[model samples]
Target: MLNAFRARFWDLALGSAMTVLFALSGTAVALPLAVAQLLPLFWRRRFPAAALLIVGSATAAHTVLGMARAIGFFPATIALYTAATHGSPRVKWVLCPAVGVAMAAASAVRHGPVEGLLMAIVTVTVAWLAGMERSEHLRQRMERAAAEDRERLARRVHDSLARTVTVMLLQTEALRATTPLDSAAEQRIDTVLGAGRSALAEVREALAAAGSGPALGPRLEMLRGAGLRISGHPPARLPAPLQDITDRLITEAATNALRHDGPGTLLTITTVPGDGTLTVRLTTEPGGSASGSQRAGGGFGLVSLTADIHGYGGELTFGSRHPAGWQLEATFPALVPGHD
Candidate 1:
């Protein structure tokens, strides 16, 4: 109620002020007509088309009566702008021409036909241009809002679902190690762990789709307590698009080590500067000697890592170790690798 009163007050205050100025300037002689044309402006946004129709009809009537003052143009100009900003584009197109014709008819009745038509055309063009500018500003504001929303959702995913998945993987490992189970039970636990790891990967991809932000490496530090050994240089700043990708790759690799390599797996992660390349290697090995079947548990993470590396003209490779485990290596082109 207060807001409605404030809006109505502002419209009346400004409308009355314009009317008085025009009256003094000999542009408007009547107060009632000018007020009628402008009073509806208070509701312009709430009902743009209806407000415009009311103002436009009043304007047409005032012009026919030869009491049309230059000040009277203010209300119509504002009404058209409100409609353009709030109404659909089709409405903008229709109102512009209609307002122009009304102005021309009024001008023809009061002044000579040629002079009135010219003045109407100029006034209508100015209103149209002002409306277009308002619409563009509104569009830009909406886009910024949508982008902010996506970033908010991304942060929530990281804080909630992603962390939960990590906890599940860690607990699964602890359960596997402490309780001796038959082969069938062990296999079931492995399946659940694998699914949890895959969910983490999907969350990482969601972060990418949400848009870039501050380096995620800092955030990934929470996983240190989740049962995976993380050893590397403190995450470094990389090239524009590469920073987020590198952070995600590191997080995903560490997660795969903990989840898929089974209980008591050792992970060795190394990252450092090389000649024109940023080198990253993650090697995972089971605690005990691996048989032929155990050696192939590298998981599906390497496929995405390979594709992302290739996008930046980098090379990615993975191979089974001689004794046990799997080693995945990727080198990204960097003009200055070690430099922050």
Candidate 2:
């Protein structure tokens, strides 16, 4: 019950001060008059500035009021100063000194000099603090916005580089088996293949080094849910985020296999985790040579794979057996290997 009254009184006091500050922006009145006029604002409002202004105004006005009571002029001013702070701008900084002097002059015929100076000093200090706090709030909001942009950029890099390179490695391997006897063409293919592998390696390193932070766990769960045909023993000890990255890569490789081959075709996937890296082996059976129809129906999965693996500094390679299946192989730095 007492809390409620305290709240109500603060509101009234604050509101009264703000109303007077806003209303009394013109020519200077005596500080004592301003305080007496604005003091009621505290009872009706909760703002700190309004409360501060009221107290400062009251202090300045007290001198004017005391003198009038001693002399034979107007009634003595009753200045009530309260303590509080608020979110809004302070009006008392401008009002207190100006009003204090004017009101003092009016009361000079009655009240004396000493008290007016003290009131002027207190009003200005409270107003300064309110302004500084407001600026800090604005600065914090801007920093939050900048951090969001960096996260978006990181997601984009994941989609483009790692995913693409993996699919391309698959396509190159398919071509390796069917190509005719042309020595120059094979050399050119080797050069292109070497460059592609190098690009894949660089991208994977970046991804591995970045270390996923908060995003690692969710990404792993998503890949595990995807339709990946797993045959080997499930890993018993893998860092959650790194395990997730590998799972996602496997899921994406499975997607490419389905995109290229009919559902009935067999796909074998193997993962070899070593001292500081992991090797992925995927073999998909083709009913025939990867033909014009297959090439025309290009898969952009490679682009996605490239982006994902690039950040981890991984490498991917492809080859095909004459008997009809294609192979996709990739190596990743074992589980964000750098940080450990």
Please list the Cα RMSD from the true structure of every candidate, rounded to 1 decimal place.
20.9, 23.6
Per-model CA lDDT versus the true structure: 0.67, 0.47
For model 1, what is the C-alpha lDDT against the true structure? 0.67
Give all TM-scores, in the order shown: 0.54, 0.30
Candidate 1 residue lDDT tens string, 1-340: 3544666677778767866766676654455766668678776755667778788777767777776546667777788776766565446778656876786677677766676667766776788678778666655554465468568889999999999999999999999999999999999999999999999998988798786544455544555555555555534655434555566676666666666665456667788653235678878776554232344543566677677677655778777776676677777754211111
List the lowest-lDDT window of 10 residues for candidate 2: 71-80
Model 1 TM: 0.54
